[model samples]
Target chain A: MVSRIGKEIELSPVEMASRYSSRALYNLAAGSPDPSTIPVGEIMNSYDRVLSDLGPRALGYPGAGGQESLVKEIENFLPFLGLSIRKGERLVVTSGAQHAIELIAKYLLENEVVVAENPTFVETLTPMKLRSSVVLPVSLDERGMSVDELESLTRTVKVSIVYIIPNCHNPAGVTTCLERRKRLAELAEERNFYILEDDPYRPISTGVPPPVKSFDNNGRVIYVSTFSKILAPGLRIGFILANQEVAEKLALLEQNDFSTSTINQYVVADLLKRGVIQGRTEQLSSHYGRKMKILVESLRENRLDDFNPPSCGFFLLLNLHKDADSVFHTALTKGLLFVPAGPFFLRGGETYARLSVAVAQEEHIVKGVRVLKEVLSQD
Target chain B: MVSRIGKEIELSPVEMASRYSSRALYNLAAGSPDPSTIPVGEIMNSYDRVLSDLGPRALGYPGAGGQESLVKEIENFLPFLGLSIRKGERLVVTSGAQHAIELIAKYLLENEVVVAENPTFVETLTPMKLRSSVVLPVSLDERGMSVDELESLTRTVKVSIVYIIPNCHNPAGVTTCLERRKRLAELAEERNFYILEDDPYRPISTGVPPPVKSFDNNGRVIYVSTFSKILAPGLRIGFILANQEVAEKLALLEQNDFSTSTINQYVVADLLKRGVIQGRTEQLSSHYGRKMKILVESLRENRLDDFNPPSCGFFLLLNLHKDADSVFHTALTKGLLFVPAGPFFLRGGETYARLSVAVAQEEHIVKGVRVLKEVLSQD
Candidate 1:
């Protein structure tokens, strides 16, 4: 029998798509980066270099937090994003950003209120909901999560953490404005809530503003990011930057499963040392940027309901003039697969659907959008 | 401030040792395979082959259960150990056995009684204890966890799961007899409890009996094993073999963090295809077997209290005639680092200590045992 928490977690759309069939013609369901841009050669070279140079040390346990060299490399890499860590602040490498969220939910949000955007990442919301915490879903517009609503909610609720994807909100793809980021940081100080800034897409996307942590003066922002989008998901490398107090606790909690993959840490460290990640990110942004443009232009030509084009990240949220479920099933019949945005929201997301430009090629993007237009026109 | 679960978890001894310094002369404290024995060359070859052959597929998401190719490889490998899976039986690859244990404890043992051996793996106990479940620590004699104690406990306490390391108990270094394994499996059915048999050390160690799962007829046993001990910990590959019902649920639960490493799965699959693991395991058993013999002889010569020399696996249990804490401190001064087995037990473990041959050289094992003898003689 599944435990209460286990029952609360459902198979995400990406998982469902993979299980259904490997023959799906247009895969807009998964928010993964283009597999073609994974830099397989560079990764293979890193593995060879790490194993040969470090010998067996690369295969040993990487300690509780992670490999020290990798952590230090991550520390060195952070300054490039306009974020700085003080002496007392610390970092803990996790399996991925999803794991970072799970650890935070388990360690920091017991019987506390967690505020998030109404239509947020479904996977992200699952961990918070499993905690049985008070999840107050604030609405998000083009400028991102409504701070005015968050402020009002904080007046009555003891908000512990506000989970935000500042750069490119998953499923919604709307970036929070700089002014709102500053206000959110200030609200965290005044209301005494922590900000869990999950920013996996920021590094590999253009027009992403500085992270909320850059505006955080009180160490209330827990900055998290993953190399899955920029480098490769198979590496399972993600890191959390927080104050020493929280970081130490997270490190201890990580002892439950030992460390993340030691070989992965070594490979990531080697890549960072060689400046491979920086170069790859630039190439990825250019590639995905083209895909995003193609999807946006195709959608506009189809005379669909007006929607904001994603400035950065994998997804584009389309506001539908009709029910999303019918459109989703019909598109599937047309050999197209994309996640329905309804599950992403706490309420009233039936009028919205998300298209991911991450997995599909430019040609597939056009074909998938045409299928979507046909499905919507049928309704 | 940390939440309840975070507060309940503490820095394990292995973690403390690693964080204390990277230059520890003797790392007998951690039960990790000797780094030098890691098949780095083979692993490098696998990586090169996987990247060149599978390309981006190696770096893509591995779905919920795992890469089908890797799962099939593990399925084929299990029959070599006298274990068979029915059509309904399933397997889920995890980050490691430790993670598999955590998942089981989280998904299956909530608000239930979890009976484990006294002085069991400290890391294994943490997840069950964190669940706030009633953990009944049964005593273990040379034959293994006293099935009589377990029977008596189950009769009164309604145990949900009996966590046993059937082949080579971690701290005690004793194997459960074949008769006892069969009895334990039968008892699980009679008592309506599940048996979580963690056997990571079984494959690479000689004289270890076939897993208790071989005796399991009614699907009451959930068998979990990791490649960390045999292949390399850095691979973070482990698999759970359970009945179809439980296997399906475990796969769904794994979706909480997407899946394990895709590249790792491909690499492992390639290695299995090439029979690298089979060969490496033979070499490892030979290597560690010699080390185990040396440590046992040195301890016997120094007149340590009578204890079971492990027939298989990594550790030796030394019953001390004096307090183990004092010996532990004194041995540290002499450049030896082994875990005091006191923490492994719930009570009366002050007189026991564990020496691991897993990470130490034969010469260092001798030197460390001599220091242990000197420290114990002082008391």
Candidate 2:
């Protein structure tokens, strides 16, 4: 029988996305990962090597956990993020970070309450809602997730899982401070609830911050990260770090779902072995950093002063003087689109917008902000 | 407040996949689109040249509908499948076929009953389950979904959706005959339910069979296909074909979830344009065909007479002389692992095992079958 949750579940946001045509106009509404920084050429070369390594056998299905070489490389990459995951502790590769999020939500959550950051990545809330979770949004400030708000929410609501983007949040682009992360981890320990620490933007940061998973001495934090942002998003590769019990459950889930794209794992592993990933990250940081400047310059030139400059990731948060809906519609007419922050907000959204710095050219950045300013000022 | 549905959703199989090690023993359980076939090298080259064609300004987030060039290519590809979709009708790149499936489940199904083929792809059921749909498994014979059973169920139950794999059913490797597809399509029209035609393996088949979608003159079939099977699963690229109304609704659903991996879409479009996809498909078909022979040869040598040979796809169903579970355990000891078929069955799963002809060397095939024999002969 179909669960009762599926029957009653309905959200218009996803439906809105389906109607979107990439050819229609500027689509700033989507929080898609940036590809300009993807090390495609190097990854392709690595793919060739991986194919050569596997020979004819590579064309077939891959091993259970993932391609060993890739998993080992993932293990190697974990330490760089300050996570101390043992090889035997469960680490599973997924289609993307979103799939991992869904998996955790399905397993740990039993239609219980989940506490999440308000104004969070709207995509994160969908799976939780589908599962019939009572998702209460924890408030956030400049320092990232409000630990105080999280504590209060947990005290009142029995939360089974807490979803957080510890480093460089999506849409908001706010990084949690180290102290807050420690407090958050400590809270999870005290509450006896699991933490899904999403860190897709870790490598893209201008400077690294210690991950919440790094402070997880009690195995409460299941650290999830993806190479899609660093190497390629299209590859649809991501991993999760968890203890054996949770890992085993997830594996059972994966056994039912399609396993992670195996050949990509092999090629990614090859890239790690060849030290291409390091070079790629460095190159990407420089490339996207330049793109970031263009967007920032345009915002400054246009005197759009209400926005916050992001420390990392591909987006900037714009606090417009006018209502976001009117500005969004006006900007769309002018061929410039940006994601409205209303949907991202857990509590009904106020007047904030998200602008991606990854894809725009230097001139458009200037023009986009000018158009945004024109729309906002008029409204 | 998070939507009630979000909190009640279950963990996904892809998420659960994290339990095992990537580098571990031989694994026959994976539906990941092979990544080596992505033509990443070609895409890298296209990335180099896109600047020249579309110019630097053309590179951004791309139009929300999709890259015009990529959608046009899909236009060309659809005709081969006998679909004549009009331009500007809703079309978008998705994360993968599985994602497209989930999107459809979210939109069209509302507290409804979904009829799926028994022993079908487990991932297919995950989204349905998460959506709280009552999943009624319709049994499958060698000719694909049993028509008599479907007709009987529809008469007795109120079903909203039916997921059918007309060509090359996963795990089972059974293709629905043209007659069965016609009957199924007729039933859908009579019952006023939508048919989700999932055909990830249709192209890989040596002989073409009429697609269930092709028979749908009434637009009841929302056909989903992926580049994952033909290109790379890591690219996580897939598409859905449906009437404008259904497509529009699904587009909205997509807005809430993660958008299709844009970088991967561009890469696929570029590969298709460069004509690299043609060579890869040929190579893939040839490779799998030969591997099937190796698998068949091994079975013949082992004198395993209980299994039926699959006409297409990479799997074969083996009927053990005794309970398949004991054979599964014994095979594990010999390091010749195949997914036990008990999990595939919806009602009873003790009699069968599923083996993939896509991997394993000829020698391993012989040895693995030999191991199966030794284990089975114990009785």
Candidate 3:
């Protein structure tokens, strides 16, 4: 007897990409980093050290909110964002930033209203849809989520939470300006709504503004970040920083999966202590920056479409005059692959496409963009 | 503005243990395995081999159902229970068996009625309570969940799922008879209810019968197992085996976390390939068997309490003459630790206590029993 799943649990873009992974050539549909950049050797060293030092305790069930030392390490690391771990602040390590978001949606936002950017990270929207009754999509300009539109929506309907990717916004590649960050935080305080600042792409990106959490003085923002972008996705280490009350609630919700992987947490803690992640993030920023530059220059040289080049992060959002879905299908046949922006929005995004420069090599980037150029020219 | 979590999301036994972890001298509270029994070196070797062989690919996102090779390894390993992986069967890897149970409750039993053993694994009940409107607790005799009670319950209330821990059942230490297993499977098919056979403790235990899944021929049983009890809990690797349709649904539910750790999956796959887990299981069974013997003999000599010595698994269920909660508090003062079974039951279990011989040394088991004997005698 099979149980029926809700529409929200159906296959999304990530699963679709994974399903047709072998058929894809350029493979830019999912936002996975270049595999070569992962520090396998360093991680191996960390594993050895963690296992040898801790023995079987490393394999034991981790404390709720994960290992204390790792939480402390994250506390020490947060100063890099111009944010300090306050006295009453609590950190709960999660499977990833997505899991952290899911926990918040499940425990806090039941039957509530959530506001997200129009072309947002689709995976984050799934949890809200499953839990909240109303998921409002606000339009985004170059500076990121239009506060005027958000305010206009909030005046009519009470918003419980606002989900945002402030730094290097996914699918759009537009960073929220410092002014917008302050205004968003202020609006969250004024409207008495929680802001879930999902900032996974911040660590490995350069010239990024501090997270909206840094500007939140009234404990209105819950900061979520992941090592998936900066370190390794397989490690599945992420943490949430919130007020003690909210953090305790999150920890209670985390009891669903017990604690996250204890070995992974210890391995990450060792890496953080050794400053391995800090050094790697610097290397990754430059490496991805170069790839983004190559993809942008190739697109401009081919005189195909109009788009703003992202200052940092793995993706470049192309605003095409043609339908993105048709172009995506045509380019797929011509051995090029990238995510169409249609699925990213709750409403309309037909002319938008997101090209990830993370997975492809320099030569592959050049080839893939040329194929896109050829397909668009024919149209 | 901290959002309030529902009362159902309050602190459970696991969280209670974590909150006072430092206070407990002898931690028999949770059923964690002995550190010495963990095959740390072999697991480390597996890690080394997996990382080197697969490199950064091992660190990337796994397939929706998990790594194909690991799924195959699990499929190959399942024949020990007299069950073969049928062509139409599929496997979805989970963070743990608990997570597998959670997914089943979330996706399969929403707003439905669930039948669980009265004194079942407390963590399993959490998800069911969160999702299902009616969670009926069926009584368990020495042969495990009473089929008569379940049948009677199902006659009145429509049960969507029957969750049972057939082999070496958690908290109760009672294994279901083969006849009961067959009947339960039959009843599930007849009642049109799914059976979630959670069997995490089967591998490392001795003389355990085949799982209920072996008796399930009509695709009514969904088998959930984990590497936590046998290999290492820190790896957080488990699998769910079901018919293709149900398996696909489970994979869709697994999308919440995206996938389990890829590196851990690869490591487990390598261990299975090398037969390390098979060899280690034999060693662990003997090692834990000796500890169980010591605990039983000590309890008998000291006239501590009446109990069924668990033939397999980590726990021994003690039937105390005195109140279990009072005895637990008294034992704590005397530096002895064990779980009061009152919390495990949905109804009355004030006199039942659970002792875990998994974590303590042989001397500690004897000493703890002596202390427990003294504390009970005082009443």
Instruction: Look at candidate 3 and give me any clashing residue pairs.
Output: none
Model 3 misplaced stretches (Cα beyond 4 Å): A1-7, B1-6, B18-25
TM-score of each: 0.97, 0.78, 0.96
Which docking band does candidate 2 fall into? Answer: incorrect
lDDT of every model, 2 decimals:
0.82, 0.67, 0.81
User: Which candidate leads in lDDT?
Assistant: 1
RMSD of candidate 3 to true structure, Å? 1.9
Highest-TM-score candidate: 1
Per-residue lDDT over A235-284 for candidate 3, one digit per residue giving the tens place of the 0 to 100 score: 88898999887888888777777537889999999999988887776789
Candidate 3, residues B187-283, lDDT tens digits: the string is: 9888889898889888887677778887877888899988888888888888888988788877876666653788888989999888878676778
Off by over 4 Å in 1: B20-23
The A-chain TM-scores of all the candidates are: 0.97, 0.91, 0.95
Superior by lDDT: candidate 1 or candidate 3: 1
Give the winner by DockQ.
1
